[model samples]
Target: MHKRVTFDNKLLPYLLVSPQILVTLVFFFIPAGEAVVYSVFSQDAFGIEINFVGLDNFLFLLNDPHYLRSFGITVFYSVAVAVSALIPALILAVLADGVAKGATVYKTLLIWPYAVAPAVAGVLWVFMFNPAVGIVAQWLRAAGIDWNYKLDGDQAMALVIFAAAWKQISYNFLFFLAGLQAIPKSLIEAAAIDGAGPMRRFFTIILPLLSPTTFFLAVVNMVYAFFDTFGVIHAVTLGGPAGATNILVYKVFNDGFIGLDLGSSSAQSVILLLIVVVLTVVQFRYVERKVQY
Candidate 1:
């Protein structure tokens, strides 16, 4: 039987949790409610006028070529970011886990990037890959490659994807390392005693144990790529080289803040919110089933 904490006073428990409830109300529900409200109405370029157009904004978005393109790009971008971040992180975590000495140092160095803001990380990468003065850019050019993300749309997408993925690596690495460390050493030893080599032991034992961590990271990384990389894309590509990097979130920003299309932006936000919710629910309902305890 599980032990349950007994509260001295029911009122005391409510008082302690009230603050968190208030914060959620203020920050999440309020904004989400406002987005839903705004999405149904049309406002002139000037914010003075408002008219309820009912599903018109959403309908407009559904028919918009640019919005469709952005949605497609976002799908591709999220997948790329999640895969790129997770694979490299898992590799690094495996390598670091095997280090008998200086393990802490390696882990610390790998995790340092997680502390940096997405925007700051993007700027750092842009400078390092700037076609004119960036060292890597110069090296690439010297190797007879015409490398310039500023003018090449595909290159710009690749750059933003790389920057987003790189920033997320530290976060993924921390979780992957923790998961790797938590696997019981006895299980591995038993497998080894049965003539299992490193690769065989890892594939048969370690990988199955890691499924839970991988699934969790998949959900988190999807969300990160969908929303949190806004700063990185803003600073690095600004959805450009011809709007080629205009993922849905960035498009929402552009339409709402820059283009001053409040209704459309709000509608997009609602759609994105729904997409995330559905994806998370699907993951929990289906993907979680495959995760090993």
Candidate 2:
């Protein structure tokens, strides 16, 4: 009985973890498997006929001009948002780190936006950009800038990109702040004693130390920009004027749910998943080569 009791105590942790393991296998793996299975198949009008058509959907998407356009737009959006968000976030993080007073207040104000839902953020931005009554629209017109998203594809893309980037600043800032806080003050002091200017110290010392955090945020923000901003695109642009805002995930939503072309949508989703996986791999590989600590 003593031995049995000891064995049960040792096995309890595994038992506790089993539920999560079971749930993941059932919910995540099963659906992913189904998606892969369906991607190779074709569905007819009745929606009941799922015939295995082996790469037909993939080939069709490859040849489709609209898919090509959306793919380009998606990549552009992700890169633009990543670059725009990273710079400002780094600046804010540094500023927060240097503040001698009210740092908490500044940090709180900066981080507040992260709490807002992307759909809500999109709605707020759209209201601010409203041509008739939006404060931003009024300011733009007064400044002699033509900024109507309804008529201009460039303006539409910019609006969506800005909105997406704006919400992301808070998330990036949080990571950056943590990274900045983690850096040893002794290193900064050493750099200062060695006659390193603030900019030089940042570029050479601080940036290198922060590379791991930056890399993490890069991958995370890229994934969010690609997959999670569906709410923003849906609420704000709905893939907008002449399919200009039709990004990959939005395209997936449009095709899979709205257009009810499940097989093609699954194919598109599979492609998007592959792109994300590839990007994640590249980031890890690049970081492994350069990250010192």
Q: Estimate each model's TM-score.
A: 0.95, 0.90
Best by TM-score: 1
The segments of candidate 1 whose C-alpha lies over 4 angstroms from its true place after superposition are 1-4
After TM-score superposition, what is the CA distance of residue 95 in candidate 1 from its true location, in Å?
1.1
Clashing pairs for model 1 are: none
lDDT of 2 by residue, 87-174 (tens): 8999998999999999899999999999989999999998999777889999999999987888788888898888888899999999
Residue 268 C-alpha lDDT in model 2: 89
lDDT, candidates in the order shown:
0.93, 0.88
Provide the RMSD of all predictions against the true structure, rounded to 1 decimal.
1.6, 3.9
Q: Any residue pairs clashing in model 2, and if so which?
A: none
